[model samples]
Target: MFIDGRGHITLANRMCDDIFQADTSEWLEHLYYDCIHDHNFVLFIQYVFLTETHAHEQLYFDDGWSVKHYEAYGTPVTNSKSQLHGVVVVLHDITGVKRLEEIRKDFVANVSHELKTPVTSLKGFAETLLNESMENQDVQRQFLEIIWKESDRLQDLVGDLLELSRIETHNFQLNLQPIDLSKIGAETERLLRKKADDKSLQFNVSSEGNKEMIGDAARIKQILLNLLTNAIAYTGEGGEVELNIYEEAEFIVCRVSDTGIGIEKQDLPRVFERFYRVDKARSRDLGGTGLGLAIVKHLLEAHEGTIEAKSKPNVGTMFTICFPKEWSGW
Candidate 1:
């Protein structure tokens, strides 16, 4: 966009029309303030004209649906005598870059906070045992047990972080092959049945149709393990947990449902986010690193699969995952 010496929009391009959500063709020769609805952009142009120099700023425009970020640069257009003619403004989209920066910051903060809790506990308990002379062996054993538990939690957190990082890397690829979902479901059930039984939860696995698909067997098992483990962990004593695998169209679907302490409506969407927990205290007590769901989501994405979660607080939660019957990796 170009504004004339009299602050009139002498020229405007289609890009300007898009950024401001207006018709630049009709805006040509109109006053900048009259045509441009974004006050910050208009002020940027005015500042460049007033200063008769280059100016730059980061600005955002909301087009009702969503907000978009842009890096705005304004340079004064002048004659050979250094007399101002107009100001030329350019906007470069930086929404993706800004979003990545935000994600990076949030990831770092979450990892640090998660690591700090266990590390603090380990240090405190170890210090108590080393610095203080304890007479009761039982009390000493209790401190040692807490230190060991914190160390185990820290190890789990680190392992999950590494697994998530590996799955998220650009070069990550699934070891796709012909696999049977029924077999995987059975194996996962056997692996976690003991935990469910310990809690007296009723656990079951059933399959119908053809449960065969082309994907990474190990990652598929990981996905099932994460979901099933969460079900057992969150459910109360004698609650029911079910794993149903079946074929749907060209996809193999696995649905894990549990009569557990369900997630609230508002928190359901973010349940897959790293370190997100509906019951932080209970999840920590259950030895959950909080990255299980995140890992499941990433592994599903790697296999070009999809997952859907539904729940009602104090009732139950169900997670349904679908994997394509055939996959040609990109």
Candidate 2:
């Protein structure tokens, strides 16, 4: 912002338009106070005029869609004789920094909450084994088993958190090679068959045809395992989990479907967020760290691929992943 001898806008930058998402044509003919709506900012500019000195301050507002943060610097323009004639204000965009601060706060809160339950369970079970159940071998064994499982869950959660931190970094890289996704799918199916059979679930995998593609085979297998494990875990007895791989145009598509309890419509968009669980209690019972889908998402991005989901309550959910025939890592 720039005001002239009459305190009217004379040299307003294009940022005036960018900040409001509108044209600043009318701003040219109006007095500075009349043109600017933020009273705090206007008052600061007035302070610069009243004191004939420079001032700096921060301001923020929401334009309905999103909140914007700004730090403004105001200066008084004076003549050769030191007569104050005008004021100039410059605004710095600080929304990204504010957002990062918010994300950091949320991450700390979420990690604390995620670890609390398992840690409490471990403590309680250990206490019972030592103080209350020492004379009873059967009860001691049960408490010890619970302690072991909770410890395992803690380990898995830590491992996933580290892996996700690595994957989310801007410089993360994949060791790409020519590998057949069909083979990976077969191996994942074999690995998870027992898990599905334990609940009498029907597990099936079919490849339209064997096709070799350039990708990190281990990561691809990780993707399949996470998806398959999630499906089988959520599914009930006698449910069906199906996996299919095929080609369409220049993309290789992998589709996994489950006949189990489905995600609510409102939860679909956030299903890929780290530590998000559609059914928290059920997920804990199934030994999930709530990072499986989040991992799947980041791994797919590393492969220059996309993933999407569709589901209905009580019907089931299907996950579709598409990989471009050729990708140049950015």
Candidate 3:
């Protein structure tokens, strides 16, 4: 905005017309104080006009739908003799950058908390085993087992975090190729069937038509394994978990449903967030790092795939995944 010798708003672009949602002609005649109510911005305008000082500031404003961030730079208008006239302000939007910064902060905080729990447990168990538990074979074995489990938890957390970071980075791309959904489901069942059997939960896999798709096989299998493992972990004895492969229109689909302690409606939207757990204590007890779904989400995005989850409390959860039969990375 332009001003005379006085600190009044003389002119503004369409974007700068923040306070007075009016015509340019009307806004140019209004003073800066009349247009903006923010104390810092008003003070900055006054200071720049009076002292002819150059300034830069980052500010936020609410436009009707949402809040937006802006970076404003002020430069003085001066005569040939270097006498101050008024200040000209330029604004740049930086909302997206600010959002990424917030996401990064949240990610770091979550990872720290996730690592600390298992690390503390491993430390405690090792100390016990080295001291009092050393003479007691049963106690020592139990403590050692706990230590091993905690170590595995830590390793899985680290591995998932790294994979998520890789998948989220701008440079990452999927190694897409034709893959068989049925084979992946079969392998996942084979790897996790023992766990299901241990809990007396019935595990089954069925497929038809080969269920071919183009995507990263390893990432796809990882997603299925995560889902299957979670199913086995959460399902009670005598419950059933099924992995089905089929074709839906032009897409190959993999559906895994389990009769388990399902998620609540309120928690559905945020289920894929890092370190978010419906049951924190139970998740930790089950050795869940809480990054499984988050990793699944990122990997799916890389492959241009989609996943849908439907659940009802105490009933069960069903995860339906779809990938294009032959994506050209278009």
Q: Which one wins on lDDT?
A: 1
lDDT of 1: 0.90
lDDT digits (tens) for residues 1-330 of candidate 3? 787666677778786555334565665667778767667777777777766789888977675788778787888999999987778877788989999999889988888888888889888888777676367788788888888888888888889888888887898877777777788888888899789889999898999786776777888999999888888888889999999888877788889899999999999878898888999998888888788998888888777788899998889999998887667676
lDDT of 2 by residue, 118-224 (tens): 99999988877767637778878888898999999999999889999999898888988888989999999999999999999999999996467889999999999
Give the poorly placed runs of model 2, Cα more than 4 Å off.
3-10, 18-35, 47-54, 63-66, 78-85, 128-133, 327-330
lDDT of each: 0.90, 0.89, 0.83
Distance from true position, residue 155, model 3, in Å? 0.1
- Local error of candidate 3 at residue 105 (angstroms): 1.0
Ranking by lDDT: 1, 2, 3
At residue 275, give the lDDT of candidate 1: 85
Using lDDT as the yardstick, the better of models 1 and 2 is 1
Report the C-alpha lDDT of model 1 over 99-195, residue by residue, as the tens digit.
9999999989989988999999899988889999999999999999998888988988998999998997888888877888899999999999899
Clashing residue pairs for model 3: none
Question: For every model shown, what is its TM-score relative to the native structure?
Answer: 0.84, 0.86, 0.91
